[model samples]
Target chain A: MIRLEGLTRRFNGRTAVDGLTFRVREGEIFGLLGPNGAGKTTTVRMLCCLIRPSEGRAFVGGYEVGREAMKIREIVGLLPESPGLYGELSAYRNLDFYARLYGVPKQRREENIERFLKMMDLWDRRNDPVGSFSKGMQQKIAIARSMVHDPKVLFLDEPTAALAPDSAKVVRDFILELKHEKRTIFICTHNLYEAERICDRVAIINTKLITLGSPSQLQREFGSGKTEVQIKNLGSRILHAVKKVKGVLKVEVSGNKLLIQSKDPETVNPRVVEAIVKNGGKILYVTRGAHGLEEAYLKLVGKNEV
Target chain B: MRFDRVWEIAKKDMASVRRHRYVLYGLVVMPLIFAIVVPMITILPFLSAEVAGDNLPPFAPPGFSVKQATILAMVSLLSLIFMFIPAFVPSVIASYTFVGEKINKQLEPLLATPTTDSELLLGKALGAFLPAVGVTFASFTGMVILVDLLTLPIFGYPVLPDLLSLVILFVYCPLIAILSVSVSVFISSKVNDVRAATQLSGVSVLPVLGFYFLFLGGLLKLDWVELALFAALLVLIDAGLFYLSKMTFQREEILTKWK
Candidate 1:
């Protein structure tokens, strides 16, 4: 549903968005993970045709970014990072105004407004001016506005930012529902867990895209495995004995505790325990090492070299 | 969205304008006082002097007589066109048109839709232009009737507003207003702050002031023939300004650089 090739945007002398290249499938939820100031907003703006790219090109719904932005706008719904709303207008009026701008037929406008507002739990406040709404409520209204016309694709820039946990959950679930409805969604956010929860595939864009894959794939790539084995009073003797076990790559002992590295834990764990017992070392506890996604993310982002 | 849709947006804008009672009062009531009340206060002495026949000072140097008094009065009232009509006010409105949306975080979604720049511009121009024009015209007529009725017996003439006055109000005021709205919208597109756009757009009235000074100095006459020509010239200029505004406006530039 979206294709970008070498897409870039520069402000003054600074490069806001570098040569970004990616593709989002028709019905997949794509996560754009990045740290703050990583040009996530700039990327989304270019896709929505709110701003032109400094170099390269982007296509949304088969419409070219610069040349056919108007056509693209017809099919794509955008929820900007900041909730842009007319404070004076009521929630209903805000949605109504946008629907008119989208040329949603007058006949269906009321129904659409009613549906979205109710979904956001903003039906009771529909007549109250948006200025009076709390920030979370305003965010929900913004979400509703973007969905008013029900476009084919949604470009949500930090959709869950500043929301209370419950409201944020609603937004997350709504995005999941959009995915089920077969709509392409491009989510730009700093919240990795949110992306992990809803995205089919995630791309981490640091200085550039450092990695792209499912969470499990990335965890497997960067996570390290080191088993911690404990012995009651092994001392240095047990470490030496376990080091002789087949498939045991390394072993270290501190007091009675042994930290071991094994390429195949299933194959070597039993042998290592048996060896420690045979050598007169009392075995206390042993647990399989686990790799975590946070470790993988930190490694991928260059927080740690190894 | 088409040009017709622009009118719908303008109507909604008007409704919003009405909702803000204080802003509405400021735009209309304040101008009415300056345009009608102040002029009457200043003109009271002249009317009294004309009645006393005490060294009947020239109403307006030489060529301005009581017969042309209404013309002079209306022309003087044209200052309200600048002072109150808010030719620069369009800057505030136009600035609010998108920048307000941006601050409120409403612009991105609006721009994300299929609404073309031209359509957006049209909607904005109407929203700003109609109110500015409406207030200006209403104030002018209100003052004219009040002054003519109040001074009819004292001046011994019906404040004979000529075809020239009609032409200036109908033809000239609108042209100047369009020019004002176009220039303000252009500035608004570039600036994110509503106040900054307003202050920058307020500069649009300088040219109108220059013309007023020229007319007062007798350097530029407002005779029927000359008035018609000026009206035509203003229309041409208004059209040029509209085109220039359209050319300079790029949604991308507004979304990015304005910040």
Candidate 2:
């Protein structure tokens, strides 16, 4: 639903986003992973037509950026890094104002405002000024505001940044619900765990696109190739037998578990399982040995910390 | 530009401005001073004066006694000061609507809407203009009633709804409002802080103040032709400032450079 070809942005000769090329398909949850100054916000702004791309081109829902910006804006919703709400206004008023700006009819505007506010579980406090709400509640209202018109694509920058863990879960589930409804969701976030949980595919970008793939695909490509096996009956013979399997590059045995490094875990894992079972080791569980997507993301982004 | 979107924006801004205490102070306090306090101070002296019949000042128009002419001259000159009310009030509202919203990061989502630049500008301008002009007119009404009531016993005629008051209320107030809103819009684009934008916009009323002073100091006369000329000059300046404000109010610059 969104396409970028060599999309670049520069401010006063300093490149914020450089040659970013990617596509987010319809009903796909695409996550943008980056650290500070990674041009994630800039890329989203370009897609939303809030700013023009300095070089290259982009299309959002078939509307060309800079040429059909109004069309793009009409079809897309944006939750900026900050909620940017009118603090003095009630939550209902805030959403209603945006619905009107989107040209929603009076009847539909009221319906959407009520529905979204209820979805956020903020219906009881709809009459209170948003400034008085907790940060998490305010973020919920912001998310609701973005979806008030029910646009085809949603661009959310740090959707759960300010929420507590429970509130963050609510937003995450709400996003997953949007995905179920077949809306294209493009998220820019530093929360890798949330990205891994919700995004169908993710792109790691610094100034340019460093890597793009599903979370597991990236873990395989960038993570150390190791398969972990937890066996109930600990045996040195099982370790020796697993090491002799073809494609098994290295093996390390710890208490009640084994870490086997291989070039291709898909083919080698079954062989290792067979080797362990044949050697009288009762295998309880077998899984990839890497530290999840976090390790792969850190390795690909070349950062030791978030 | 779609006017419904423009009106929506204006309506929302008005609602937002209503809750802002600082802007509310400007909306209520400035008009009160212009309508009630200033008139009470200016006309009370003439009401207490003993009759000084037929010793009229040279600048007074042909038919009036000295006391009558003094009251009319003071009221006429002071009516020009009412022009300053529209010029000043809009700055208060626009500062919050533009710079306050900008600082609060509210403009990003607003700019992301389907509305065009002209519609947004026109909406915000009207949002500031309407209240400013409304208050000015209300204050003008109050001033007319108060001045006439005070002058009625002495002169046996109402001193207001005169040509000067009509011209100032209908013509100059709206133009000055447009000028104030346009200048404030321009200032809001350049300044990120609401106080800074407001302070800078206060300078916009200087020309009106200059004319008021010139007339009060007897350096300028309140003639029909001269008033029309000044009104035309103000319209030209308002147009120029509005054009400049529209040019400065780019969505991209507001998003990028406003930091």
Candidate 3:
């Protein structure tokens, strides 16, 4: 639903975003990962038509960014880094004001406000001024405000940055619900665990696209393929037999556990288990190692830290 | 331009202003003091007592009776000085609306909407303009009534709804309000702090104050010709300031240049 080709933006003499190229498909949850000053917010602003790209072109919902900014604004919703709400106004008035700006009719505006506020669990406090709410509640209201018009694509910048763990879970589940409804979502976040849990695909960048793929795909490409095996009464005899198994590239012993590395764990795991069983070792369980997307992301963007 | 969008923004701004206690105090109190208290304290004493010709203020015109001339001079000077009320009141409201919103980061989402730049500017201008003008008119009405009631026994005729009152209330107040709003817009774009924008916007009323002193110092008279000329000059300045403000209110600059 969004496409960027060599998209770049410069402020004064500094380049905020440089030569970015990527595509997000319909109904896909695309996460944008970058360190500070990596141009994540700049990229989202370009697509939202809040700022024009300095060079190249981009299309959001089939309308060119600079040429048809109004059209793109009509079809897309953006939650900026800050909630940016009117603190003196009630939550209902805040959403209603935006609904009018988007040209939503009166009847539909009321309905959408009611629905989204309820969805965010803010119906009970809709009459309170937003400034009085906790940071997490305010974030939920902001998320609801972005979806009030039910746009085709949503761009959220740090949707859960200030939320507590429980509130973050609520927002995450709400995003998953949006995914189930087949809407395109673009998220810019520093929370890698949340990104890994919800985003169908993610892109790591440092003024340029460093990597883009599903979380597992990225982990596989940049991470070590290590598997951990827990066995009862594990000793050097079983370790030697498991080490001799075909497809086993390396093996190490740690307490009653075995660390095995293989080019293809799916192919090598069965042989290693069989060798352990035949050697009279009681097997407990075998599982893949930790998700290494965080390591891959840090390694790629960690250099030249600002 | 879509007027509904404009009205929506204006209405929202008005609602926000209503909830701001300090701005509301400025809106109501300043006009009351300028329109009611100053006139009553300064003009009512002149109507109650007899005055010698030598004791008359310099601006009092000679052809009429002492009572007539003194009442007319007092009403005219008070009405002209009241123009400063409209000019000063809008700067307070506009500063709160523009610079306060910027400080709170509330402009970003509003700028992201489908509305055009002109619509947003016009909406905010009207939001500040309406209340300032409304209070000015209300205070002018109160002053007219109070002046006429006090002077009717001495002059045997009501001395209000005169050319000065009509021109100041109908013409100069609205233009000065627009000028103040436009100036506040420009100042808000240049400065990041609300107090700084408000302090800078206080300069907008300097021209009005200059005219008030010129009349009070017996250098200028309150007549149709002088009023028309001043109104024309103010209209030109208001147009130029509005255009400059619109040019400065670029969405891209606001998004990028603000720290």
Candidate 4:
């Protein structure tokens, strides 16, 4: 488990992470969602004992950040923003070297290295230099390197940032597997979909904590009260008519679907449909809550692009 | 101080240094010149044209012919150059291992390991120190053999491993290596580029160069007491620089302040 009480970090008087207070339950997959430069990575670094907080305190596995950095470092594995793998060394050597640094016994180090490599489907290329691997493969090796010591808590900062969709899926599956193994995973990501799909509890942050809850809870509480309507043969006249409908707040057209925001959807939905029907529009599909997380995230983190 | 952790870090960095060809070539070329080329050029002349005590350079034996004194001074001067080996090797390797790792972003995970800052510093310093002192010892061994074989028929004994040579080898080289490693560690923290770190750390040998220039200019006479004093001064400088470097290598400084 990880806990932070009013943790703050500042560089040259400019705050990077500010007054963060939260706790991640043991074995839960927790996501710290933020835009770029939102202090997500900074928060993770403070928790991993890579950097100390300037104000307040934090603990990982009951070990304080600044006081017991060595102990926190011993129990927590960090996958930094970059993979940071040694290019010239073999994958096995890289993992073994970390395991040794963590003081894992030699026999067990060997077993963990082989196990993680095989799990990543990189066992056959274990002997080759990591420089020879592709970006995704290098990421896999980096993931394996972090797990070499069999740490109880893991801090992953953008682990799937630049990976291909399939490779990202593989990383997600591996994270889910770690959850099954009862490891606390704190992930920092700008990928709202990934966080929504995998995180048991998600915290949206932009320098300070904005909101924290399960994905559905956030969606339900802060979900955009927007209705999505797919109209066949939707014309400019029909769009203009819908915009003129009373109580209709905003209308955004994405291809054939009209995402409509309204003050009272129960009353306005009938009027908007009547306006569309009078304008000779054909309706195909009606849906909501499909992208509830994205709307909620954009609402919470603001309209600035992540 | 878990020595196993230190050794592991040292071994890893050394293995990384082994693969960097530029650093490897620098390590190789300098030692070869110090051992083979410099000895042949400095001592070969004394085979027939040396052994007089009257015009002896500093630190020569008390009783010796002109030819013998010149040879001893040459050997002793050559020993002075031996100190340059430790002072130079670390710059090349440390630039690659320390600053280069920082540039390549390989140090975060390294710093994230459970090892304490002191262990990390000692391990890295040893990583640079062992290769440097190894090269110095190996190169010095070659010089000793060549000097003995060249001087045997004239002096009728090995003129090598005399008191000055022993002092420089046992005392001076290790001290110089420590100073250089400390300089490299300090410079590695200050400079982001590997080339800049290497160039800046080369300034560590400026003291050795100053001593060499002073002796050549007849401004210094390194008597036994002077040698001890110089070694003492070097020890002080090494301590101060080491303390500064240790402060720079702390975890927060490394993570937030390095770049």
Most TM-score-accurate candidate: 3
lDDT-sorted candidate list, best first: 2, 3, 4, 1
Candidate 4 per-residue lDDT, tens place, B40-81, comes to 999886686745556666655457777777877788789899
For model 4 the local lDDT of residue B227 reads: 84
Better of 1 and 4 by TM-score: 4
- TM for every model, in the order presented, reads 0.83, 0.94, 0.94, 0.89
Interface DockQ per candidate: 0.61, 0.82, 0.86, 0.70
The most accurate candidate by DockQ is: 3
Q: What are the lDDT scores of the predictions, listed in order?
A: 0.74, 0.89, 0.88, 0.87
Q: Which stretches of candidate 1 lie over 4 Å from their true place?
A: A225-291, A303-306, B16-22, B51-88, B154-161, B189-192
* CAPRI band for model 1: medium
List candidate 4 segments past 4 Å from native: A225-290, A303-306, B48-62, B219-221
Candidate 2 structure quality by residue, lDDT tens digits, B107-174: 98899888888999999999999998999999989889998888889878887898888998998889
Docking quality tier of model 2: high
* Winner of 1 and 2 under TM-score: 2
Model 4: per-residue Cα lDDT over A168-213, one tens digit each: 9999999999999999999998888899889999998888889899
Please report the candidate that would top lDDT against the real structure.
2
lDDT of 3 by residue, A2-60 (tens): 99999999998898898999999999999999998899999999998888899989999
Across residues B131-237, which tens digit of lDDT does each residue of candidate 1 receive? Answer: 77777667767766766776677556655254655665677667777888888767766666766777787776765676666665556655667767776777787
